[model samples]
Target: MHESLFSYINQNAASPLTSDEEALIMASFQPKKYRKKQYFLQEGDVCKYVGFIVKGAMRQYSVDDKGAEHIVNLFLENWWVSDRESAVMLTPSRYNIDTWEDTELLVATVADMVDLIGKIPLFGQMTRLMDQRSFIASQRRLNSTISNTADKRYEEFADNHPKFIQRFPQHIIASYLGITKDTLSRVRKQAMKK
Candidate 1:
C-alpha cells in the first residue's frame, strides 16, 4: 500500500524520496478501508483527513434542495481525495464524499501533511504539481460545461477519460458532464454510429 504512494511520489516529484523521507511519510499516513457506499465525508461535517487512494473508486458530490445529487468529481486509484476548503479552513464541507467500491486509502491529517511538506522538499514539489493539475482540470471542465454542446462534451470526455466511461455508470457520467442521462445515451449512440 505504501509502495503505491511511493511510486506516485517518484512519478510526480522533482526528485525521488530518500529513505528517511519515506520513513517520515510512513509515520504520517495511515491505511484505511471503506466498503462500497460508505461515506468518507458527509455534508456539513468538517473534513479532517486527506486520502490517497491505493485502490477502488470514490465520488465527491453535493445534494441540491430538490435532493438531486450533482457530482463534482470522480476518483480512482492513485487519486487524492479531500474537501480542500473544509480541511484547510476548518469549515464544514458542502459536498459529500463516498466510496463507489470497496476502497483502500492512505490518509493523513492536515497537520501531518503540513509537517511533511515542510520537511520533505520532494513531497512539497509533488503536492504543488498535483494542485496545479487539479486546478487546470477543474477550469477545463467548467469551461467545457459552459461552452460545449452536450455531444461535444461527451466526445471530449470519452476521448480524454475512457476509463471513466468504462468504470462509472451512465447516469453518474451524465451528472459529471452536466447532461441528462437520456442525453448521454443519445450522444453515445450517435458516437457509436460515427
Candidate 2:
C-alpha cells in the first residue's frame, strides 16, 4: 500500500517527517492502476501527472522515423517516472510511457506538487534530491552511449542490473541497450559460454 511510499520518502527525505507533514504530503497523491501495456503518457500528449510506482514495471520509449522503438528508461516498483519536460513546460511529450505489467501507482499532478512544495519544505528537499539523481543517471547513460562499444555497454548493463535480464523481456532490454535483439542474443550467448 501507500506505506511503501512513506518508507521511500523516509529513506530519501532530508529529515524525518512529522505526522501532520506526512499527512499533508500524502494527501496530494492519488492512487492509480494500469493494466499491462496500458499507456500512461503517449507521444504528442502533455504529461499530466508524475507517478511513483507502488508495484509492477513500466517502460518509457519513443518510436523513430523508421518505426523502430528506442527505450528511454525502465521503471520498477518504488521508482518515480515522468516526462519531465512536458510536465514542467506544458508541452507535448516526444516519448511514451507504458505499463509492462499491471501497475499500481501513487500519482501527483503538477498542481498538487506545487501545493506540496509550498506546504511542506521536506517535500521540496526530496524533489531536489530526485532531480539530482535523475540528472546524474542521464549523464551516465549519455556517456555510455557515446563512449562504449555494444559489448561493453551490454556488459555494464548486465553488471549493474543483474536481475533485469530475467525480469524483463529480451527485446525490451535490447531496445534499452540501443542494440538489435539479435545482437543482444549473440552477446548474451557469448557471455554465457565464456
Candidate 3:
C-alpha cells in the first residue's frame, strides 16, 4: 500500500525523498477503508483527514442549490484527495468527497502531517510542488469549462486523464465535465472518429 503511494509522491515531488524519510512517513500513517458510496468529506462537515488512495476510486463533488451534483475530482490508486482548504483551515467544507467503490485509504491527520513536514524537509518541498500542480490544473479546468465547447472540453479531459475514461461511469464523467450524458456520448463518438 505504502509502496504505490510513496512511489507516486517520490516520482512527482520536486525533490526526491530518501528511504529513511519514506519510512518515517509510513510510521505515523493510519489505514482506513470506505464502503462503496461512503462519504469521506461531506458538505457542511469538517474535513480532518488527508488520504492517499491504496485501492479503488473516490469522487469529490458538491450539490448545487437545485440539488444537481457537480463533481470536482476523481481520485484513483496513488491519488490524494481531501478538502485541502477546509482541512487546513479547520472549517466546514463546501464540497463532498465519497467513494465510488469500496476503497482503502492511507490517512494522515493534519497535525501528524505538520509534524512530519517540520521534521522532514523533503516532505515540505514535495507538498509545495503538488499544491502548485493542483492550482494550475484547477485554473486550466476552469478555463476549459468557460471557453471551450462541451465536446472540446471532453476531448481535452480525456486526453489529460486517460485512465478516468475507463474508470468512471459515463454519467459521473459527464457531470465532472459540466455536460449532459448525451453530450458526453456524442463527444466520445466524435472523438473516436478523429
Candidate 4:
C-alpha cells in the first residue's frame, strides 16, 4: 500500500530514504478509503488533510452561481490531493474535492506533514520538488487555456495525458480543457479523421 508513495519519494527525493526514515514517514500517514462519489472536501469547509492517492481517482471542482460544476483539477494514483491554501491558511476551500471512483489514500494532517518535513531531509526535498512541478503544471495549463485554440488544447491534453482520456468521461475532459462538450466531440471527430 505504501509502495507507490515510497516510489514517488525515491524518484523525486535528493537521495533515497534510509529504512528508519521510511518507517518514520510511513508512520506519519494514515490510510483511508472512500467510496465512489464520497466527499473528500466540501466547498466552504476547511481542508484538514493532504492525501496521497494510493489507488483510484478524485476530482476538485467548484459550482458556479448557475449551479454548473467547473472542474479545476483531477487526481489519480501517486498524486497528492488537497486545497493547499485552505490547509495552510485554515480557511474554507472554494473547491469541492470528491472521489470519482472507490479510492485509497494515505493522508496526513498539516501538522504531521510539517513535523515530517522537519525530521526527514529527503522527504522535504521530495515535497519541494512536487510543489515546483505543481506550480509549473498550473502555469502551463493557464497559458494553454489563454493562448491555445480549442483543438490544439485537446490535442495537447490527449497527447500529454492519454491516461486521463481513458479514465475520465468526455464531459469532464471537455471541462478541464475549458471547452464545451460539443466542441470536444467535434475536435475528437476531427482528430479521428486525421
Poorly placed runs, candidate 4 (over 4 Å): none
Residue 89 of model 3 has an lDDT of 85
Q: How do these models rank on lDDT, best leading? A: 1, 4, 2, 3
Q: Which candidate gets the maximum lDDT versus the true structure? A: 1
For residue 23, give model 3's deviation from the true position in Å: 3.6
lDDT of 4 at 141: 95
Candidate 1, position 42, lDDT: 99
Per-candidate Cα lDDT values, in order, are 0.95, 0.90, 0.88, 0.92
Candidate 1, pairs of clashing residues: none
* Residue 192 of model 4, lDDT score: 91
Model 1 per-residue lDDT tens digits across residues 111-150: 9999999999999999999999999999999999999999
RMSD of each: 0.7, 1.2, 1.6, 0.9
Q: Poorest 10 consecutive residues of model 3 by lDDT?
A: 8-17
**How much is the lDDT of residue 59 in candidate 4?**
94
Residue-level error in angstroms, candidate 3, position 150: 0.7
Count clashes in each candidate, considering only residues at least 3 apart in sequence or on different chains: 0, 0, 0, 0
Sorting all predicted structures by TM-score, with the top scorer first, yields 1, 4, 2, 3
RMSD of 1: 0.7
